[model samples]
Target: MAFVLTSILGNDEAIKILSYKWIWSEEFLNKIPLYLLDDLLRHYNRSTMEEHKLLEILAIIKKDFQKSSENERFRD
Candidate 1:
């Protein structure tokens, strides 16, 4: 849809986007174990799967938030 949207360059759209949290949601916010964030960080220190690492490293934090809209959380 790049052709459908206006160009963000030199426009106020970029600023508007940066100021907002498009990725934030009830599910993602709740799933992120804030209390164990430190422990989670430890996982990145060791060697791990390349694809998973690529997604975690290259993907923006907001992009992950956006992805949550499509992917669902596990239910008990």
Candidate 2:
């Protein structure tokens, strides 16, 4: 999940969505690995050309996370 998020962050749309104050809160940010965060900072520091494609990927990830969260809630 962290890898996917970091990879998607390279896209401008993903960056814009993820950079929101609520979305980029410390709790969510802390879940990412340090190395992934460093790589994202160094490599994905700027937006990429494939913004639409990457945003699609981000949407898929978001859907998966929501499903997983729902499943977890049901289990609890």
Q: Which regions of candidate 2 deviate over 4 angstroms? A: 1-16, 19-21, 45-76
lDDT for each residue of candidate 1 in 28-73, tens digit (9 for 90 to 100)? 4454445334433555346332444334432444455354442243
How well is each residue in 18-76 modelled by candidate 2, as lDDT tens digits?
Answer: 44443445665565456544554555545532445445545644654554432232221
Q: How far is 17's C-alpha from truth in model 2 (Å)?
A: 3.2
Q: What is the C-alpha lDDT of each candidate?
A: 0.38, 0.48
**Model 2 error, position 48 (Å):** 11
With a 3 Å backbone cut-off (N, CA, C), the pairs that clash in candidate 1 are: none
